[model samples]
Target: MIKFFKKRPPANLPDFWKTYENCFLEKQPEEVNSVRFVVLDTETTGFDYIHDRILSIGALNLINKHIAINQSLELYLIQDHYNAETAKIHGILKNGRGTECITEIEALKQFLAFVGNAVIIAHHTIFDINMINQALERHQLPKLLNKTLDTSTLYKKTLLTSNVFKKKDHYSLDDLAEKFDISMKDRHTAIGDAYITAIAFLKIWTRLKSKGPLKLKDLLKLGS
Candidate 1:
């Protein structure tokens, strides 16, 4: 009789990953006000996810239209890849005194721990989500599993869709900020942008709710 080698079981995910993943095990709240919303933004070296590096990630939780500024996440990541051309855009120099920068792994760890299973809201949801997913992939981790909301799309839903006013395919954060009268005080910075997004989202939520009863499911369904 030939003896066959026993197949080994795949290793379990690390404790941090497990902790992040476990947040989803509990059912999400059904009501909009009861649900937690995490508005997030990332500042990168460039557009190409494969080549670019995330210089910073800023995020804060919004609940019942209130954001506790003291509890926000404003993480700057140390860089190995630098782009001089884009420095002016994000204002995060390679080794400048912006904030205490951490390693990529540490940043990812902190970001994951902070985000948990809250609904993620961003301006252009796909771009930021893809950028983060790419970073996670490079670190040999699973992609983000949280539901995402795009203020761009949600903002469109609040608009009047008539032949008189055709909706543009895309809307910039600045456009929404201008339309909603949200100040551009912290336009490019990660945490600043996240705060702007949070305010814009609350305004849009009011518009959406004005039409009818808007549940958490309604907003989740509208977002991509």
Candidate 2:
């Protein structure tokens, strides 16, 4: 006789989380131009995912090649862990930055609502996505279900094979800014960097489309 282990029941999630999850029930758009994309950046205390915490999150909505300035989101979290060294980099003080800081849970709620089921875009997406997921885990919440695109990865595909030797293994946001001629005015700030990444993504997307037709699946494949 074989004995099987019982599956664990789903954890009771809050209404906001439930609402966020519900958005995924609708089918995702197949056309690249039709899909809503959320370009985001997160400033953290340090590199250690488990040990460090997110100091702030900045994101904006992009659809049909247009950046929705009014839909942009910027949230600062009240941190229990702060690194002075990193603070010098991001400039988010423990006390506050004249802007009101919300609790991590509150930030998560707002972030989820703002994000919905939109595809996430970031410079180095894994780090930012992991940071957000870790925060969600800490609150007994599940990780984000949205698809993601990394500008660094997507930008790499825009390069020509003739100049293969000139390609670097990794491309930094600063490199994209200089190559695309975007301003570096908000270099270290989360929202500023996100805006820069959004611009870089648009430029990269346009270049990719110049070669051939680019559907959402095709772009996601290239990004992956």
Highest lDDT scorer: 2
Task: Write down the lDDT of every candidate, Cα atoms only.
Answer: 0.89, 0.93
Per-residue accuracy of model 1 over 144-201 as CA lDDT, tens digit each: 9899999999999888889899999999999999998999988899999999899989
Clashing pairs in 1: none
- Per-residue lDDT of model 2, residues 118-176, tens digit only: 99999989999999999998998888999999999999998876654677889999999
TM-score of each: 0.93, 0.95
- Model 2 — TM-score against the truth? 0.95
Worst 10 residues of 1 by lDDT: 6-15
Against the hidden true structure, what lDDT does model 2 obtain? 0.93
lDDT value, residue 224 of candidate 1: 67
Which regions in candidate 1 have their CA more than 4 angstroms from the true location?
1-10
